[model samples]
Target: MKAMVYRGPYKVRVEEKDMPAIEHPNDAIVKVQRAAICGSDLHLYHGMMPGTRVGMTFGHEFIGVVEQVGPSVQNLKPGDRVMVPFNVYCGSCYFCARGLYSNCHNVNPNATAVGGIYGYSHTCGGYDGGQAEFVRVPFADVGPSIIPDGIDDDDALLMTDALATGYFGAQLGDIVEGDTVAVFGAGPVGLFAAKSAWLMGAGRVIVIDHLEYRLEKARSFAHAETVNFAEHDDVVVHMKKTTDYLGADVAIDAVGAEADGNFLQHVTGAKLKLQGGSPVALNWAIDSVRKGGTISVMGAYGPIFSAVKFGDAVNKGLTLRMNQCPVKRQWPRLFEHIRNGYLKPSDIITHRIPLEHIAEGYHIFSAKLDNCIKPVIVPNAG
Candidate 1:
């Protein structure tokens, strides 16, 4: 097997590795067909997240065929094509029973918060991820579902993380009909959230980003207004002005650790590792939104303290909702939306690289070169 192993910051290579085998009674080994490099993976690539050990594979958005399943895995068989959610959890746990699969208590002994996430880091559970020819899925019955008849593999791959998380972010917004929704960041999650806001009856959807290419995607794919924060003197004031001075009814933060617009924050958080993650995006969400509006954060941040505007959020009476996104929970509506031609999740996929070229893919995506939006890894490609 060949897997993308993390050597150090900005260093990764596809190296020959031992094939995974079923390690638990409820485990299953999947032969990966399609996998995606998520925005969150950049955190590990840049060495921002703690406990990301060298030699660990970093990928969570993946879909594949089951190679083998343990005796206890009754929901799936060896030949089933499955779209595994990023979460690795036991379905019967207290959190899982409440549809909070991302916070399952039975997995990730290191976490008192988020549950097991494949390939994230030791902090989220040190399980190797699917950025390879194969991966081992624990609690297989609870996490993966068979790819539906009409769904494309690329679409299935995005559903595992980006699409699901973005949809969950919109759901958290609790958007009333005709409300104004402003999304921070124009990455996959932000794009999807902007698109989903329309489905949730938002009268106006605005996507904020520094990149014109992504803002263009927001206009075409999301049918929303675009805000290039780099062109503004103060993005918060610009957002307020754009929303008629009262501010947007809802604001969602989709840019996690490596947000731009603030050099000091980025240097301190993403570069110097002084804080968990740069709080620039979240602060923008707080400052740009209306006083009583909702702020939904779908961005991936470390499990450590961040320099956020908690006092301002309290003062404004904002409803801030966020989570790792119970991916499976969002699948039902998302599937319906995809089937009805309301969304083509793979529309955002700008690059597809072979497993061996994952390092180059990482470089292209990390550098934001070549208009790269999303990149998929084909592990079994010829």
Candidate 2:
């Protein structure tokens, strides 16, 4: 099998690797049909995420066909199409029982707090990822959602991560009918966040980003109102004006570490004075949201922390929710939405490339070229 292996920072190589097999009674082996690069994967590429070992597989967003399943895996079988959740959780854990799949107590012994993630790092359990011809899915019954007949693999792929995260963000932010929502960033997750906000009955969905191309894509594809932060003299002012000076009822920081404040020099005027939040987009979203509003952060963050105005966060009585998405809790709902016509997450996918050309895909996506939103990699291409 040929798998994309993480060699080092800004380095990934397609290398021949052993094929995966059913490792546990509850496990299953999947032949990957489609996989996509995620913004969280960028954290690994840039060396910001810790514990990523050399030769480890590097993808978590994928949908595929089940090639084999262990005896205990009764619900799924050979030839079943499935989407694997990015977070691997034991369904029987204390946290999992409470619907907190991201904080499952039975996985990732090395995780600083709780929960585990696929292909994230050693700290999240050194499980090989699905960025290859095949992968072994532990806890298959709990992690792999069977794709319904007639659904395209590309469409189902979003359920693996981005769609679930977007839905989770909306759920955590307490987005209700008639609420105005502002989402920071226009990446795949951000786009979905905006879309989810609308589906969950938001009165208005405003997406903010520096890139005109992404904002445009969000507007056209997701029907979101976009704000081009790069063109605005004051983002908060622009947002306030858009929301009639009350600011948004709910704000989501989807850009995480990639925001302007992280690269301090990129920000101008008042933004320069702040130390920038650990996940900089959080601060940006916090400032842009109305008082007493809720802020949901679904962006990836590393161990190294940054500073934020704690006093302001407290003073405004803002409700801050942050962390990796609890895929187990959200996947079923997203899957149901996909099964119906309620959510079209596939609209965010802008490029499709063969696995052999993954390096090219990475280059173009990492450079944000050609208005790339999401790039899906087909592993068995000729």
Candidate 3:
């Protein structure tokens, strides 16, 4: 098997690796059909996530066919085509029973925060991801679901993480009919968040980003207004101006660790590693939303201190909701949305690369070259 192994910051390569096998009674070995490089993977690629060991593969969004399954796994068979959610969890746990699959207590040793995530890092349970020919899926009955008859493989792959997380972010917003929503960042997650806001009955949607290409996607794919924050003296002020000076009814921060706006914050958080992650986006969300409005955070941040505006949030009576997305929890509505032609997750996929060219794929995505919005890895591509 050939897998993308992380060597160091900004360094990865395709290397031959041993194939995975059923390690637990509930485990299933999957031959990966499609996998995606998520923006969160860039945190591990840039060595921002602690405990991201060298030689570990980094990927979480994937769809595959089961090659083998342990005896205890009864929900699926060897030949089932499935879309595995990014979460690795036991379904019977307290959190899982409550639909908080991302915080399942029985999976990760550090489950006090996030549950097992495929190919994230040792901090997230050290599970190998599906950026290769094959991957090991634990708790097979709970996570992976059969790909529906009409769902495209690329759509299924995005549903595993980006698409699901984006919808979850919108759900957290609790948008009322005719409310105005502003989304920070214009990546895949951001674009989906903006699009989902419309489905939730938001009267107005604004996507903020520094790149014009992504803003263009926001306008076309999301059919929302765009704000190039680089062109604004103060983005939060701009949000207020557009919202009639009261601020948006809701704000979603989809830019996680590497948010660029404040020089000092990015330097201390992203470059110097002094803090968990840059709090610029979250702060912008807080400032851009109305005093009593909601703010949803779908961005991936490390488990450490971030200088967020907690005091201001308290003062403004804002509802702050955030968590690693419970991917499977969002699938039912997502499937319906796709079937109704209301959503197409694959529309954001900009590049597809062979497994062997994964290093180049990483470079292109990390550099944001070629108008890259989303990149998929075809492990079995010829």
TM-score of each: 0.98, 0.92, 0.98
Off by over 4 Å in 2: 262-278
lDDT, residue 268, candidate 3: 64
Candidate 3 residue lDDT tens string, 189-216: 9999999999999999999999999999
| Candidate 1 residue pairs in backbone clash | none
Which residue pairs show collisions in model 3?
none
Clashing pairs in 2: 278-306
Q: Scored by CA lDDT, what does every candidate get?
A: 0.92, 0.81, 0.92
Give per-residue lDDT, candidate 1, residue 134. 95
